[model samples]
Target: MAKKAKKIDIRSDGREFDELREIKIQAGVLDQADGSARVDWGITMKRIAVSEKTYNKVESLREQFYIIPRGKGGKKYLVDVPAKLLDKIGDEFGDYEVVGEHFKGNVAIVAVHGPREPIPRHVADPYRAVLRFRYTMAPFSVPERKRPAPGRREIEISKVSREALQGVVFANEYPMTAIDIFAELLSADAGTRVTAITAASVALADAGIPMKDLVAAVAVGRAYGHLVADLTKFEEDAPDAVDFPMAVVPRTEEITLAQMDGRIAKKDLDELVELGIKKAKEISALQRQALKEKYQRVVENEQ
Candidate 1:
């Protein structure tokens, strides 16, 4: 018979097992990217950008804009406009009704580019869009200034975060093109991978990319043998800690990204997943609210 896992009192700092660390997602930190967001959790801060795709033709071909229904039970509308009108449309109204909730630090930077023109020819695909991602941490982003450039850790994160987002984006719409995502750690934080994924989803929407739904992510860990949502550096470094990071689409309740470290009992898996999903929904709500607030500002500026 297998030995049973020991149960330990996980509560520390007066927190409940289901409670998350304090979180804040702030959108619109930098205007240069098609969309940008910042998430602050504990001591970490993360900034992300979703930029306009590079191909002019791809952007010009789209002929519609989104709007919520006018009244109760009214269907939401996608008003078709002339292709030429889209050409006349400015960059200001691109984000529409999107927002990001929160996560951060070890300052990871992930940039998603393209859905534009394909370059170099060989990498282009005829049937669907090509997405590429790169993740890196800055030399100055850590407590001890570290060497810059891509390393094994950076590469691993890039791949996982990309996978987390691939299912949600409407990649088929831009065949023969490439969409690139880049994430850099501007500072060190325990949950940077999840934070980057969360921010990237908002950035894609902000850039007006077609997506089935937005993605949100968060980390859950076992501390003192108790399941906890949103682990911090302190908890992550704990000798008994077990970490699980996940990304999901709230509309479909689909999990696009999930990774685990340390050990978990088969019986405990269900509760951990439940906790992560519940928190993901909460985070998704905040993302929508953020977008609404951002668009509100644009409306005010226009008036």
Candidate 2:
């Protein structure tokens, strides 16, 4: 007789296979820039109230968790605990309650400046404006302090991001000029490039730049023998992982950027691309909503 296959639980964070991590975006976050946006994209972890004695046990590792006082006087504490750690410490807290939740993921800020004259007059194109993108990460973005310099990875992401939005911008309208986009990752878990691209699109719109449509991006891949819509850092590091990030124009469904890191069957690749496009549409809606909210705020301010 054939043996029954054992069931495998792929996701430990309780997210659906096709569901994306919680994402919050705000446009016009910076006043000095022509346009700016901030995106907080990541998972939400439950905050549990614990006694002061219990909190002290993990004080040395506080950086890894979101620790805060439950209320005034600092009698009790609330820690945004990860799923893995919950199993070990869940019983230690004395009469604790599930207080709330907090987000832990990539935080990206993007600023857009100008349809101004290009630096070094000779570099300006006669027929269309040039698009320049600068992608950088804060020194404290990751667990370890990163060097404050543009490394090869940053340079490559900048190039791809510039290309991703090039097709949407009406560059011909402002010939002999430059549109500079700056994206900074304040915190990162995974999918930093996609978060930057998503924020940059909104920043450009907020700057009043004419564009065909907003570009939305997401990463879709296979993890633990299952096809996933958005791969977290845990999934990306899986033994049999395939990380494919793509940027798409929602209206026309044009693929602006496509990058694959691991190998997969052709059939699986097709399915993954389709999944990415679907997720991109959802992201596009959020981008539009953020722009609308910014304008609404302006109207309220004037009133």
Highest lDDT against the true fold, candidate: 2
Error of 1 at 13 (Å): 4.4
Note each model's CA RMSD in angstroms.
Answer: 20.1, 5.9
CA lDDT of each candidate?
A: 0.65, 0.84
User: What stretches of model 2 exceed 4 Å from their correct place?
Assistant: 1-7, 47-101, 301-303
Q: Which ten-residue region of model 1 has the weakest summed lDDT?
A: 63-72
lDDT of 1 at 75: 25
> What's the lDDT for candidate 2?
0.84
lDDT per residue (tens digit) for residues 151-245 in model 2: 99999999999999999999999999999999999999889999999999999999999999999999999776678887877667666778999
Residue-level error in angstroms, candidate 2, position 117: 1.6
**Which is the leading candidate under TM-score?**
2
Candidate 2's TM-score: 0.83
User: What lDDT tens digits, residue by residue, belong to model 1 across residues 134-231?
Assistant: 76777876658777867788888889988998898888899999887666656665888887887777767766779998899989877655788887
Lowest lDDT 10-residue stretch of candidate 2: 1-10
